[model samples]
Target: MMITNNPPVLNDTAILNIARDVLDIESTALSELKAQLDENFVHAVRTILSCKGRLVVSGMGKSGHIARKIAATFASTGTPSFFVHPGEASHGDLGMITEDDVMLALSNSGKSDELMAILPFLKRYGTRLIAMTGDSTSPMAKLADVHLLVKVNKEACPMNLAPTASTTAALALGDALAVALLKLHGFNEEDFARSHPGGALGKRLLTYVRDVMRTGDEIPSVVLGSSLTTALLEISRKRMGMTAVVDETQKVLGILTDGDVRRLFEKDVDVRTLVIDDAMHRAPHTISPDALAVSAVQLLDTHHINQVLVTDEQGVLLGALNVHDLFAAKVM
Candidate 1:
């Protein structure tokens, strides 16, 4: 039998077929992980949840990379966690682990020497261990208080000897565990935002109008009977594009903007003697200082307004915001 040296030329269909095959194999592996998520998985979750100290994840090589990602996901989602390289653990880093901490060990073969070498110390210290391995019968699995099996029938690599399929399976399992732990801990959006203060989602979830809006003395506010000139000066002084026209009780009665003054000029209205009420737009829409900036964005879009007055529940002026403010805060 002769093996053909010349393989068929690749085509779009062949490329798509290869991609589909890889996805199918990985999908099958993930389905297997889901099927195998039994009582042991729940036990692992319970152990981590009940741990008084942080979750310490330890692994070697490729498993170490996945372990670090898993640790980050856990920390950002509400569970306190950090990753520890097994090679370093024997070199004084083992001091980082405590009886209060739970160790999550990752090994494809369940027999990494660096990870195994510290097991005796971990056990002596009475620290709980959760093992993730491809082999359920391996020593690490047997020694662990809880073992999560990430078994894959074959690798997605064409040579059938790489970590592709196994790593994908492990990553999916780690995500599942993190989501489960999040639900178990009742982690909410606010909690997640607190952990991620530098991102867009963090700003959206954690930032209230009060945190970003120009407040109090920074606001351009004029009495309800003030002249349009005074209102314009207030708007210019505060640079908020508009001024809130308030009554004697400091309750917002209307809003005066450069646009309103421009309209008065176009209609030949007296600018010098015209009170703010004569030139003001009454019952202008307003937002609460506690409202989400995203809500202010929606209101701005819907009403075609450049600015909105920020008020308390009793219609008292508290602050003001404009599209520029949203832009400055990156909320836009």
Candidate 2:
């Protein structure tokens, strides 16, 4: 009988050790990248900032994946940018680029034929070229307006043929560039939130008190000197768990809550005999119509109350809202 050769099987310890080694190698490569930040990086950032048009990122293979992520980071951080495949650039996609635009190219070997083919077209169109590569002496790097060094000492693969450490270094460098530009442009959290309005952070940042508060006839309120019975009826009719006590001019005087009613009952006093001004809590927490809805939610939580009055600068009641309103608006 003839027996076939079998592949070697790795034990648990060997598998774990290989994984640890890969992580260690990638970590060291990142450390090296931090040290490689120099004047060339500054020049690249300056070129991108000075460009009048959008930034166009292009790469091949693994570099293409990293390039797409970099483009997204830049766009979300207030920089206008998009990615183009090098292969497609040679086709009709090159028309997407213009003379005013800047091109950011990624190539682990610094010698991707697809990218090299479009280099001349970019140059002829007067588009600035920023190359991220491992080989500073390669033709692509030498031809670039600015070269960002992303070289790695070794690959994580045992054969040293895969683009592992080099790709990580390139991705880190791209992130660095994006963050630097973000700061340079004074991009703040609000700007980022605006770009991502569908996200939770965006909702919290962009939602204002006026956007969620119950306005017009929806607001539950009683005029000053109104009987506690009248106030209670208004609260029950509005179903907001409370009612605002306002003056003749609609200026907020105080707020009466369910807790206040409970306390009043505990006192064994006839609530019908008291006026709303006597039972309502003075100096109640109030929010401005221009304030963020998140602020209203925080006020409700901090004061341990279920409702708050929305007022204008003149202290006039503009609207009212409860914890439920905030929940319905997804502000909580």
Candidate 3:
């Protein structure tokens, strides 16, 4: 007989209980942190708001990881900030700090050796300090112009030694700070899109019809008196699946699509004898070139049409775009 290679299975209820216990502990820590917020929290925000220079956040070990994310949040949401590891700042990185800058130091114990080593130098240099720590009486807290206490009742770790719940609370508080500052500074979606121009959201919010519409010779269009066959040829040549029918002033009169051609064929109509007037869709859907690309998508979806004409305020045809254009721009 050979020993079985099957792995031991955990009790489902026990495994779920452990996971839920961790979440409950962390959630409780956040609620307590909310209750603990007082004038100190206000002073921290005020100090950063009045600052003429950047916010330089520093921490050590696990707390340092949280501080880096906090710094990134601040930077992206209108507050100029970056992380400096306390260990590195104790060495030559200390020169990066300036009296005009505000230093935000994170240390759960408030007694990190590297951080403590730089506090006196920072004090002497006259850089305003904001400290986030568990101990209000610790040297880091005592030296800070404003102390935002992040004292959690306990860690989520079963051993109660890891920086689990405390780190979660710190991260949440940092997010609260960033969000408050951006709102106070009147940051909007356009501002956020500018900050994230390379992402899909940027494509949706920043792209305009003028930026992607086909103009000049690329526009598939036919004159008002052109034959249906001429319109079809123009559509095929431009590869847009539709052609705009325009008058003498280049004002759009109607649109003739491949779908219309197919329907006309199904009705046994004499296509060779027809003009654009007989085949074109009157007053076809149109959009403004200045409108956002996403608005064109909404028009297409609302009308159940794949192509839309771009027009100026006076109803003169400017250009055109289709669903494929928005897709290429990642606006769809």
Candidate 4:
């Protein structure tokens, strides 16, 4: 490849037009690809579901990148799949494929020499092969147990040499397969969360109230019989904007919040004459420490409150959480 030190003059209008044309071409390619789905697709899904071992995806060149992404999608969605380079597999990585496993090979032209070299070995090994390609009559397609035709009308590249629309169509088809398998396998958000525990979705779905709540002395709380002034002091010291009012046995009796104090002042009541029992809300929204953090967030949203108490089955305050706590946990 030769680097051009002197490039052509910039044409902003032409660049934007070319961008639109590229999208239009890829969009049409996907539409045509959708119309081509058939029973072979069904057979492919069933084949994967019946697979007792991992799915091994293999490809060459640009299709290899698409294969890697498809493999990742399948793995994250509970299919237990991974990508293996056909070139590498021909050397010794083919050992990763077992008789119980299924192999999905990607090759747009269906004639990549590297992928072609491994098909015979997979056949003798009894590993099922599913080929995604553009030509049904190609060797890779003919050798596959299930052939998924991803043939596009034309490449998005004006020269029709670079992979553009074909790759997009292949990627979309991979998503379709992963989603279909996900539905059939009964994989849910929690399952996805387990596979992606470091991601935002995992944090939202997996984190519990106990995981993010402030406990022990760190929690802002006051006992029953405490004066309104005492409760306010606890709230200010803990900086949670609220204090749990608990009985002698630590059972929740009520809750006192800054917003409640504001309401009292709004009515022009004498603050000095107020007691904790008189000022506190008799019933406060509470959640279990074991509940999902997202549930706590929703509880606060539903009640239009910024803070919530975490309680045990007997209504004993175990911990506390505010909007900031949820934000820190990234559950919001």
Candidate 5:
């Protein structure tokens, strides 16, 4: 018998090389997809744009996972969409499909049994079909009113059978479709923020101090001539680490923080008789209530101040912000 020799072991470098090969293959597949964009892609987008009802996405296995993610991307980016497993659709989920809805199906081989089983039912419902497949002549593509060809050169898997490059190509195609529609609809960052209110981008873009900051009775404010004792009470009541020293017109003059109070204590200053101006930091950094929370974070970092007083362009005191407020808003 002839003995065959192969690499003896897998080391970290070998593993990393394998990873790089997979990434390179997938990257090439996606880049190839960009050149294939043509009138067919445009028709697909137009069909989806004209859709009055929800978009129903379906696939099997790895394609199913990508379909679910694509559905989520569509839903969050101004297009109303959801994913329905192809197998589930055959069982009972088909009831979710309606005449007004558009169906999007994904199949690497273009002939998944589960997906094929539902084609008749979808056609019967008069639902338009958009197919994403590797072969345009495949059954699913033939049945589709619009077929998006995602033919990839090869799989990134060493076995050349596993779904890797194909899936990446499909994912990139889905993103391209969603973003194209988003731009056509003129979706802006504010609209995106509305869709993802819990995320950091949303907080950085949409959050304003007036939406998260203490104001009116909750805001710690003391007159310039007020005694340090009164300022301390204001600070304690608000618990915002600082109090704004303002003139009688409610225009901010300075700020008195816990650090200033500690300094006063070290100096054995008389709180009852000393005015707020005697202990406050003059020319304190401030912002407008309309300023984004991210901007406030920048101010805090630049001046090394934990709190920032919000004022109008006329310099009238409006509200305040602290590092805690930025934390709570997720702007930090």
Candidate 6:
């Protein structure tokens, strides 16, 4: 018998059929998990919520990969959690687990030898165990304070030997638990933003108008009685492409932009003779100093304007910002 290195040829239809079969199997498994949800899930959620210390998620093999992701989700959402390998737990790593902590163990068969090794220690330390397993009758499940059944009809693998559908089921169940805890704890977007400070979500939630807007002398402005030429000079000097027309008290009366100047020129009107108020838009778009920078982006995009004035409730001009500023701040 000779073994060749040639690869097997597969048509697009055949490839698509195989992909669909895998998806169908996983989808069915998820449906089964959904139908199996009962008071046991509620008990698991209650156990996690009641825990004073962080959640310690442990697993081995493919289940360990899912465990790490699930721990990440829990940590980012609201519940503080970290992953621990059961094999490593037998070593000094078990010191990471505390009495107040709750253990979420994942195993398809609920009988992983490595996991079983830590069961006695977990019990002796009074650490609550929440088991996610396929077999509710298995030793881990029987010993668990709360059992989350992630049983699947079969693996998506052709040989039904590798962990496929079971892992998917575990991941989805973990997500479900995390989301439920998030809702119960009233973990809003701001809380989530705090945990994820370096992402786009943080930029949107944490970056405020005051943080990015130009203040004091940086703001381009001209008095209400100032001439169009004076406003134009301010706009050019500040390079904001616009200037605020304000009263003596520094209250925003109107806004004059390069576009307004262009319109004045298009009408063949001599801008030098016109006052700033004559060419200014009285109903200028304004944002609060406390508003999110993302809101400013929306205002500029919605009004199709390049820049907007930042003002207080009484219409006092405090700062100014342009689309370029938002882009520089990564809020755009």
lDDT of 4: 0.94
Per-residue error at 135 for model 1, in Å?
1.8
Model 1 lDDT, full chain set = 0.90
lDDT of each: 0.90, 0.92, 0.93, 0.94, 0.91, 0.94
lDDT of 5 by residue, 222-275 (tens): 888898889999899899989999888999899999999998889987778888
Q: What would the TM-scores of all predictions be? A: 0.85, 0.89, 0.90, 0.92, 0.83, 0.96
Residue runs of model 4 more than 4 Å from their true location after superposition? 3-10, 223-225, 263-268
**Which residue runs of candidate 6 sit more than 4 Å off their true CA positions?**
1-7
Off by over 4 Å in 1: 1-13, 225-237, 257-279, 292-294, 301-304
> 4 or 5: which has the higher TM-score?
4
Clashes of each: 0, 0, 0, 0, 0, 0
Off by over 4 Å in 3: 1-9
Ranking by TM-score: 6, 4, 3, 2, 1, 5
In the range 109-158, model 2's lDDT, one tens digit per residue, is 89999999998889988999999999999888998999998999999998
lDDT of 1 by residue, 1-332 (tens): 99869877899999999999999999999888888889998898999999999999888998999999999999999889999999999998999999999999999999999999998799889999999999999999999999999999988999988788899988888888899999999999889988889999888887778878898699889997787788888988998788998988889999988887777789997788877777787988999988889889999999898999999899998888999988888878
Query: Candidate 4 has what TM-score?
Result: 0.92
Q: Best candidate, lDDT-wise?
A: 6
lDDT assessment of candidate 6: 0.94
Candidate that would win on TM-score: 6
Evaluated at residue 172, the lDDT of candidate 5 is: 91
- Superposing every Cα of model 4 onto the true structure, what RMSD results? 2.1
Candidate 4 clashes between residue pairs 3 or more apart in a chain or in different chains: none
What TM-score does structure 2 among the candidates reach? 0.89
lDDT of 4 at 230: 88
